[model samples]
Target chain A: MSESYEATVTDPVSAPMTCDSNPVEEWLRMDRMPHIWCPGCGIGTSVNCFTRAIEESSLDRKNIAIVSGIGCTGRVAGYLLLDSFHTTHGRALPFATGLKLASPKTKVVVYSGDGDLFAIGGNHFIHAARRNLDMTVLCVNNFNYGMTGGQVAPTTPEFAIASTTPYGSVERPFNLPYLAQSCGAVYVARWTVYHVKQLQRSIREALEKPGFTFIEMVAPCPTLFVRRNRLGDGLAALESYEENAVIKNGADTRECDLGMGGPIVCGKFVDIDRPSYLSNQVAHLRKVLGDRYVMPDAWQGVVQ
Target chain B: MVETKKSAAPKAPKGHVVINTERCKGCGFCAQFCPTGVLAMSKGFNLKGYHPPIIADAAKCSGCGLCGMYCPDFAIYGVKNGRKPESGDL
Candidate 1:
């Protein structure tokens, strides 16, 4: 289907002269095309999957709100052309929870790095998942604090070297999918940057599913994490993930922990249905107040 | 475009690649993971001094956006010559 267009397009010669635009161009703020993430960082790849998922869902874009905490991944909110908020460190989940509560119809997404989600906001993460808030939480775990210059983080694998832990971190890292699963997340999945298609598909699935959905994206931190650990460049890091990652959909979350180097189990670990925080509240209020209860306009028919 | 179902040789998937050279940070992700080896890093550097991937063999392209999927910078994307938005039919 070669046409006359130059290097940028492959449109047919007889096809209508539609505007030349990349699929992602429409979703992003063009002015921020060159994001701050260093070359080979996995955050950009995750963003690609995210845009694709949003497009696939066919949801009203205006009704979706994205919130991010302070970190390299937090910059995503500024890049996407949507209602986004770059909240304080570790506060992204709470902000997203409030957003979901205020407007039940709006799709709230909390995207942040491991440091922000697990280190600073660990309590919020556990509480939100326990409450089964209706929101999607994407934790881009680079293993360390990338923005703070390669410091050790809560998700840094045990025995991994970081700036703060030159002799190797002794603390056991949090197994993200396991944590999410135990905390009562409705959906739990983990994927490295190499599993772009799977990550995108899971994000899409999480977006549509009600209640708390948690996705752990193991992206490369080329500038800090990779360089500090002598993990070659970003490409090498991604290649390592490709080589080591084992797809284990429906695997037990207990076995899905990452060591310094070994088989990296990646898949959708848990998917179960239950009453969401909002849905449960609405259901109980209606039963107690009977005819006197006034159901919120958005949740009128969503009692169950 | 002539409809050529001519079944003897399976029609190879066609793809269009749009590269923003200036936006590229010279990451070899697109070239390294192009499944079909349709791209290779160029010898010359962009203004940013990074060697962006150039189309090595355009004909081998299947229009799978894996290159775009792995790309850290929004420097490159592959578009399948589908009728319309069906290419990104994910």
Candidate 2:
């Protein structure tokens, strides 16, 4: 089957250009070329979707601010030539929220890892969703802590073995989409690296959304996770994702249970319009602070 | 002067990166390594607060496979334009 599929996959050289019209390339940080992800890692796939979405949206790089946290995924902010913040672990969202509130015109995005968001930063995640801040939160779930070595993470499945869980992880994993919906995120969706086109479309829509948006991407961890679990190589893991993932309409987080041994659900889980935190804050300030909030006397003043 | 008819150029082969989530831990390793500025972390937590890596650009992959190689979890890989070289033939 692998041989047959390989035979059918298009050759990179002859494949039709799907990304030519994307304008983000003009501002790509080529100096950061040869990024350091391991072979067969899915973060590259996620990156592809992100750039495509930015290109399709035709967003101005000058008006965008990409923020990230600690771990491999957090490096995205540094790689982009646009204004970015390579911040502390599990704090990408908070920083992004501050940026969005300070500059309502700028499009702030927080890119972070599972451990950063779910483990240490779980509280921040829920608040960000509840507040419905005007920002895009893209979470890259790989299953274990890949940077500091593969340890059992909050998303690690029950009975999955990790460095920390030598006998297999007994803890249950969190259902991301359901959590986002319940917390009031305006937009929520899940996509794997395989569905590149759909991923790009969803991202573009999420970015255009007026309120907080969350996209959970299912990527592979062939090195640590696969090696620890003995799940073969990167290609084999991708094949597994292709086999296990089931695309269904109106799928929600409640329906997905990593411990249940069911089909992996993938689709646009939710999209709704709500009052953004930034807009609400501005309104509150206008009502409360009023003229008492004195404007800075000078745009760029030099104190004598 | 003779008018020269301009022809549309052939499109370049577009490459992309893909992730296998079941094998992913949401480690954010790939998000850190993408050179073309395409990947990002998900805001929501997966079954594990591990918000799997997402592809932000399907077209800018350049087929480098750097993320896949650097991924400690090996959750990332490349989908090139052409078929894989036949086994025992490469």
Candidate 3:
């Protein structure tokens, strides 16, 4: 693990060389370093886990495509050095579904925020899970709409204060894991920013799952959510995760609804195998057409 | 005549972290998240007028890399003073 070199006069040869290469740089667009995320924001931490999972899985980097919708978490696709799509608001799941169907060999990942996924795109989320489409969806739940000011969202817990809910929200929030599991997601997991190792491990597992894998990542929105809720700075928010999170791996998703106060349940709740949409379609075509049917190559002509 | 001095491969340095002080945004995440409590915010300010973290105890560093994992900015990372592992080990 060493290279010998003969230094020339123009080499300056003033200082000893060291391995300055950073491990995180290889997976990122280094020129895009110093991302727009607020200081101490947890989205970047999730990005770290993502790159690590990609590396650990030993997948071909070129075949992985990242898709995102409009929001703070959506910026993940732009920062990664992969084939990424930043689609319209609340449309990441559908876009990813199309991409996955087009190129079955390519690994498609949809990463976006709660407001973008659960609020506006909830119908798409449920349908995609119901169809058991092959894709990984990572939702960063900051509990409110971070990009469009501190507005309340479908995932915002009841009684939590948002710019839109100054008097406290009377509406109940959706328990994402429960919703995903009920909608037929094959894999469901949740983790907070403080659980870095667990988050990374869950990403690795979700990447390996075959159909409709979903991970709910809770992060701190220092600028908007934190300020509006009177939650302390980003660091304090992580401290809160440490204090409030409870790991219950096999707990029923029905009882895991998170509230404004009390312990937040986090773990992998559902994992089971069933026929995926494309797989079932292929099976049906083979059974009906017999020798007449020929399987088409991924990314091949579908319109024809 | 040009003279070139050949130095033996540098010895493996001790495990320590180097902070890019200017890049820090005074988030205090490193100080709060360090498992060994080896980091603390310095009283001094960087050019950006933000307090940066400093190594409070060099002896406690095990190079666990939690600081780098939690840091939103790529301002901090772990430095290992050991032989590089074979390729494909990552």
> Lowest lDDT 10-mer window, candidate 1 chain A?
A1-10
Per-residue lDDT tens digits of candidate 1, residues A5-118? 224433344222333355677778888666788888889999989988898886789999999999999999999999999999999998988888778888999999999999
Ten residues in sequence with the least summed lDDT for candidate 3 chain B: B81-90
C-alpha lDDT of residue A38 in model 1:
87
**Which portions of model 3 show Cα errors greater than 4 Å?**
A1-20, A299-304, B1-14, B83-90
Best by TM-score: 1
TM-score of chain B of 3: 0.72
Error at B26, model 2, angstroms:
22
lDDT of 3 by residue, A119-185 (tens): 8899999999999998899999999888788799998889989999898999999999999999999
- Provide the TM-score for each candidate, comma-separated: 0.91, 0.69, 0.88
Predictions in order: lDDT: 0.84, 0.71, 0.80
True contacts kept of each: 0.36, 0.05, 0.25
Over A1-304, each residue of candidate 2 has an lDDT whose tens digit, in order, gives: 1211112123335543332212233444656744667667777668767876776786775788999898888877877777989998888888887776666778888888888888888899999899988889999888888888999889998898899999999898988888889999989998877666677789999988888899998877778987788887665666677778888757757987654234678889898888787557556766899877543333112111
Residue A289's lDDT within candidate 2 is 97
Clash count in backbone of candidate 3: 0
Quote the positional error of residue A13 for candidate 3 in Å.
Answer: 16
Q: Give model 3's DockQ, 2 decimals.
A: 0.19
